[model samples]
Target: LGNTIVFPYSYKSSYKSNLLGSSTSPIQDVNMEEEFELKDGDVVTEVVDGIPTIIFFDQVHKYIERRMAKTIIMKLLGRSIGFNVLLKKITSLWCPRSPIQLMDLENDYYLIRFNSEDDYNKVVFGGPWVIFGQYLTVRLWSKDFSTSQSKVDTQLVWVRLPGLPEGFYSDFLIRAIGQLLGQVVKLDAHTNSARKGRFARLVVLIDLKKPLMSKIKINGRIQRIKYKSLPIICFSVWHVWT
Candidate 1:
């Protein structure tokens, strides 16, 4: 049984009888015991309802550490997208160092594995990605992730404050203005340094269920808000359409 992968099983006194099945083979019985022996912290037990529950802690840890570190879980909000289409679009957009593996999960969720950590970080921290006029919500993969229970209502969107006063470029002031739109996630380097005067750019986590703010008033002056890759919205009916 050397180098053979043994599956986890419950320990019982009749385990030898079950494996032998009336055959009196001492060697076979010894091999069976060796195969199922709990050794080297390979298996951990927890008492549940007066029964020991076996946990393959080492196997699970290795799987997650090697496989899931550069993996991300994502889902397209308010729409169902095909696997091939999503793969094609995101591959082209991300331009990863190596080809990515895309797997479709339960519900509308998708799992993406990247070969490079740089690619993973870029996609995770990247803008509220928009595909086919719909927002793509992205999150890091966790061991206890559930497709049905995971719901996304907010996205990190880039908002441009046009004609923002030069004095408002300070980090504190910009963040304060960003609160009017949504939770401030980050500020563009150029915007924070005041190198770009056209508009102040910052990333905000905006709620998708609410109407997006088109303009904001500052010091009794109207400042128009520009959203990047935003879906079409009908102001008359206050309805947003993808």
Candidate 2:
């Protein structure tokens, strides 16, 4: 009922009486009858710029508030998976503590509502989630989301600097090297402590359209780069797979 304007009986009577006083009322009774015969529960819409726009009152906010913390939107990049298949695969992969609800949205997008906040957080922070060899992009739901124009251009990926010298494990040096691939998001715990000598792991935000860097020259020596959970591409048919 917040921010919703309700006309009481007196107000409606007063308005009708005031209209009767005028010989030529701008708003006629017939027009009023046609427009204001509102039901107890009806979705209200008004014309705005020649387009019908829904009028959401405080009640809408209440509904949104209930689900805001536990709702997320997801889209699979470069591929479309059946709803049943995707649901089954994701349910098994995520294994949420409580049940989850999935709703199909426009443009291969899906809405997920989790019963528990812990499940929501796990899904939100757990990926670079991949399904059917395609990246499943997960994002917190927003009011301004538009499926038609939205595009998945960037993604968080774990990159490995294999055979890197132990001396280069310093925070400053590792971050500097990580820049060669993309924006360095964070260093893996073991990599930060240099406990894992085999390779240094860093989470990087990379552009999907750009060709991934295979190697970088540091001090005139080449260092090989490896990506975890990267999709494999078949050169013959240009099909990507896990």
Number of the top-ranking candidate, with lDDT as the measure = 1
lDDT of 1 by residue, 1-242 (tens): 01111111122223345335435523234223222334667777789999979788776567556656777777887888876677667876777765455666677788776656677768876755878877777766767677775565455667899889899998889999999988896799999999999999998877767777888899899999998744455544444442
Per-prediction tally of clashes: 0, 0
TM-score of 2: 0.55
lDDT for model 2, please: 0.66
Candidate 1 Cα RMSD (Å) = 12.5
The C-alpha RMSD in Å for every predicted model, in order, reads 12.5, 15.1
Q: Which ten residues in a row have the lowest lDDT in candidate 2?
A: 1-10
Output the worst ten-in-a-row residue range by lDDT, candidate 1. 1-10
